[model samples]
Target: MSQSPHHKSFTARLRAHKIFGGIKPAVYKADALRSRVMPAPLPGNLVLPLLQHQGQPAMAVVEVGQAVLKYQVLAMGNGPLSVPVHAPTSGVITAIADSAVPGFGAQVQRCIHLQADGLDTAAELQPCLDYRALSHLQLLALIDAAGICGLGGAGFPTAEKLRVSIEQGVELLIINAAECEPYISADESLIRERADRVVSGAEILQSVCLAKRCVIAIEKDKADAIEALSTALQDSSIELLVLNSKFPTGGERQIIQAVTGFEVPRGLLPVDAGILVQNAGTAYAVHNAIVEGKPCISRITTLTGSPLQTPKNFEALIGTPVSFLFEMCGIDKSQHTGTIMGGSLMGIELDSDEVPLIKTTNCLLAKSTGEFPDPAPEQACIRCGYCADVCPARLLPQQLYAFSRSEDLDQLEEHGLADCIECGACAYVCPSHIPLVQYYRASKQAIAERDRQFQTSKQWQSRFQFHQYRLKKETTKALDKKLPGAEKTTANEPAQPFSRDQARDEIAAAVRRVAARHSNRTAPSSAKDKAKDKDRH
Candidate 1:
């Protein structure tokens, strides 16, 4: 029998598929999941963290004893890179301390404990319904006032992204619906349920960026989502593109390529190619920010895994504890030994369920022993190229593994270690079951630490050099001032044999030449011509 041509490649090996063992899909649910249009009653207590968005954490303006109302700015966003923190509900500020944050690497963050007043009283909001009359800057101020951020994993301030896009001349706004991760159904569910809101948000983004076109790209697997968005935006300029459901297709770079066929170069942003990509959830948030007076106080989270009694999406409050979520779902944490904040592919394991939800907590997975068995003990690498074949970033996993193992920072950098997205795709496919992503992360962290130290050293060196230069200039100036006829000195005289008057003449002449050149370039053409004619006469 003739062998098939496909048998020659990794596709054949992948087809074998013996490793995963046909694991059944698990259903996870959020008990209190609510729609943006619906008025979901606020949680009993809201723990609004100071650092909700990316960039510098917002500075807390309210004291512990102070009372605050809903939509009130409890903390002010710091710098151009951050967004303000708003009270999720009317409450008395209880305390500010290091608190647990879910899906985040850091166990402790600056958290504001709020005891909800339960009245949900309105806070004074600066209204700008007639946004058309406002300038772009005015629109941006409104967005900032609404405390909007990306809402996707990035959590970047929305206004900052818009400002950058406008300044850089963005042509296309790509709305990402490619929720390619295994268990993350937040974006999918949002688009299916709130197509109109998502479309409206995209329009707002379109207006802000002044983009020529808007494209909502969803995965082909999400047929219902594609249909919903397509129907909603059929008459509009927004185009819906169904992309292949590849893992990491939801990544900024990948989606940019999938939609516009433009690859953002390594270490560059999507805006560099005149493209701006925002998450579907982010678009929805933008819509709410513009039309309705709301900040990103809550988001849809998928609470899934076999351990849970019920599995469905929930619109979770930002500061709700993970334990509270599990309790709401009627899941007994005692029954499950392991819990992860994200999907099995890339989620981080939680030390405890006491962690409070943050902006990036997309899904919470509780795994019983039967559902998610612990990985087999890691073994030595046998030089098999399986890891490389599955790497979404197209990096040499084995080589990176080798460099990481040896702590060869130079070699790792040369091998493009920073490009690793830590997606665990390579580790998932490794025949040797090496934790390639973990090793890469360790290496990257070490490299980052070293770079930080280098930067600090460079900063100190720069300061030292600057101080030395200043001292030298001051000393020279003092010597020139003390010397006879020193003010007349110029560059023509040697420092040792300093002829003050002659040096002064040389300096004056050089200054005159520079001033004349500048004046000639900046002066009116007629004035320059007349001066030239007078010189000739």
Candidate 2:
């Protein structure tokens, strides 16, 4: 929800979550938000990626050319970390193929292309007559079934997040309405039009959270949203905190520190700190899923930037192409060179406007000529410490930049590179114009690759250790095998684990396999060349 200083009485409580560090940049919301939100019909063919959320792509449940209804389950994912993908409207599945994803290049994701028949037919939905009547698990199951996720861009499955919060004994529920990013007002629009729904969703989440206190953390500049929510929660026990209008002030950790004066520890979630930060858009989505018995297939996306004749917010389908929004705004699709997702400071340039909207897509900015002029070539860092000063996570960007340049993971982690929110505060203030955020992104990806490999190896090592533990216990009994005539069908003998010597040998075999895999990847030279090198050596 948009936050403002309308509730002046709550200012004292708001001061508790003081602003930490952030940088201000040019905001382009005035022209963009001037035009109110309008519903954009789904494009000619909706291209829905099964991997809209933050886990494995949902497995397709329908075959090609099969007829489906609006809100019908196109794919299902029951994994703890995944959410299902649903059809946006009644259509036939035309193709399920790899397609280009927005914001990234050279990588293709599996997408379900649906050809709309204009039927607008919706599937039958089973609604919970009274949400209060359902148990917490039942509500979670409903949310999971609805494929609801963090609509504020993280795309983390909402059910899993709520379940984790409940499991971790989360105490405070901080509803994030910071909407601090410029030119992106989906949450603001939702709050302005449907603050009641947002509040109702918050109440439901609070019930599931079993939280002792609830806080709506929003920027004080959002006067309308603040007034709406102030009135909405007038008789409620929740606290309304109108925070400073700082860039990235709506960031998870920043808002957490701003509201509760608690800094989220590195490599840990906000829940670990006894807090659960959720987007206002997400809460509004939860309200829609449970109260309306609707599946998530559409969202409010800001289609702004200068390329279009008219820039405004559109309530578009989940898989509608960016070209559709451009056409809606009467802009030529070919001129979308700087089509970016999200706001200026943190937005990623789209390789093509054909990229379809996803649950996490909050904004689509197609810059017109000279809107975002090219930056000067990056110069060397001068150690001015300005990047450090503006860093919201308080990590040393210059140091991270140096380590990332050298591809040093140890120092990067030592300096807390993972904590950086990539809000571009450092890069914004840097005189060098260093793409520090990009470097950090690269570093994070690299570290993640290493962490994945390390985890696999650690699991094998754990298996080996467990085998050894069982082998020692096996010494007390002839657990490996019984003598031919001795103790037939003895039930008291302990169930033995894998043999330790065999386990050790298996581990050795695994090491060799891993080494061979790495060698095959890194050394693709011919056998002749290898022999020649060996002879030379």
Candidate 3:
């Protein structure tokens, strides 16, 4: 973690421009960083979820009992919004059923279960060392086929994002190495080992997006990672920026504002501000895809907590169960209920250790009862405005809190609730520990549901209107038909009338339909009554 001679001046330049409103909590990641990342052993069962990416769930291609090799496509999605799902190890598809896979927004989803045979086989891979020679569409297709997505917990499809940014003429690309969350060192450890790949990946992304400049934004406190990146980007034009370390500074909006001093307008994306932010791990994955001809099958995850024998990092494959890593560390988990997926502040607690790791799983914290106790019972908000003071989004969280509790979605949006990143900055600074993020999440979910219902109602209204229009057109055509030998019939002449039998049949059918409807409404599920009715008939 030696500093270059220019490190003093380089540090001062970034410090001169600082972001507003963030707290610096104690980062307990020293032990994890002390050791290099180790490859996690393949568990007995690997559960690959179909919907790992942001868009729709990829359709499963392999059926139960089918054999698959490492890096083979297990599922494929339709279009630009999704990436393919690949097998991590050579295995037989033992089951493909509804199941829980970790790293989603704290809920269970469908998964494809695989049983490894330990052979570690691979399918045929089309390696392209000359990505620069490929056309834009061809290159994007390659990235899509490789199943690449954002690893910074956003889980957005990388190819789709790059495609849109390129179309929109992105000006700046920012690579995030600012592992600002406490107890998370996956990105830092990855950079420490593979800084070259991260830089090269940034170059690829820059070319894909056609950005004017690429900058690697790291925290000033991470000296080792900074030094490593400095060496890697020395021969290149990419700039290494060292900013003050603070919670939520690693967020997309916050990082963009910190680096370029441009506040992304509310309800707009970072690309809307002429900037694109990507994670260091995502950059590394891109490099692996183009240069090494590898699909995204594994990610560097930080494994740390008090219950474990040692805290360290692991390059764990997707679908490795959380408890398997705990067992690998030889930990005593008797006192703990389950495990937390990410960091202490933003991570979700899982009641069962059976959850398997997916992309965006940066840490597996097996906290002891004493080390990671439950949040205290919610205390009443004191109306002290402390939450508003530390909000990085510059949002009035106090107002959002009241609107969310009251289920007032209209008021919530009017007061800028959507602008909140739920980065826990407000909750972190709350003196009453009100879990402000939870309230916002619930309110947003409610609003989304309401919007969905409204859209459905609109669709139904349109359908009804179309149906009425069709009926009117048919009725007019029938009325305007000329009668036989009446080519001289006047324009106001009456149309042909229904025959007597036709009218009788139509009335009888309507009567039968009404009678059937009434009978169904009054009928009870009794076999004896049905028999009695049949006998009476």
Clashes of each: 13, 2, 0
Where model 1 places Cα greater than 4 Å from the true spot, the runs are 1-41, 103-105, 124-134, 462-537
Ordered by TM-score, highest first, the candidates read: 3, 2, 1
> Which stretches of model 3 miss by more than 4 angstroms?
1-16, 104-106, 135-137, 482-537
TM-score, cand. 3: 0.86
Q: What's each prediction's TM-score?
A: 0.79, 0.82, 0.86
lDDT (Cα, tens digit) per residue for candidate 3, span 175-215: 98887889899999999889999999898888788777788
Candidate 3 at residue 26, lDDT?
A: 90
Q: Per-residue CA lDDT of candidate 1, range 1-537, in tens?
A: 012232133211211111111112232222313322222346677787777667888888899978988878888888888788878778899998888775444567888998888897977655457656667676677788777787767778889999988887777788988876777788888888899989988987888888777888887777767788888997887877777667777777767766655455678777766778899988887777777768777787787776777666778767777877877667966668778887777788898887777777777888888877878889999988877776656688899999899999999999889878787878877778788878987898899899999999999999999999999999999876775756446444656666899899999999999999888868767877878868989
Task: Record all residue pairs in model 3 with backbone atoms less than 3 Å apart, i.e. clashing.
Answer: none
In model 1, the worst 10-residue window by lDDT is: 14-23
**For model 2, how does the per-residue alpha-carbon lDDT over 1-537 read when each residue is reduced to its tens digit?**
112222233323445456567977767777666767789966778998888878767889999989999999999985888889999999899999999887443458998999998988999988766899988788888888989888888788889999988887777788999988888988887787788989988988888887777888888778888899999998888878888788888888888878866666677677776678899988888888898898888899888877788888888998998887788898855555578888787888887878899999998888766777778799999999999999988888999999999999999999998788889999989998998999999999999999999999999999999999998889857655776455544555766677899889999999999999788758778988779879989
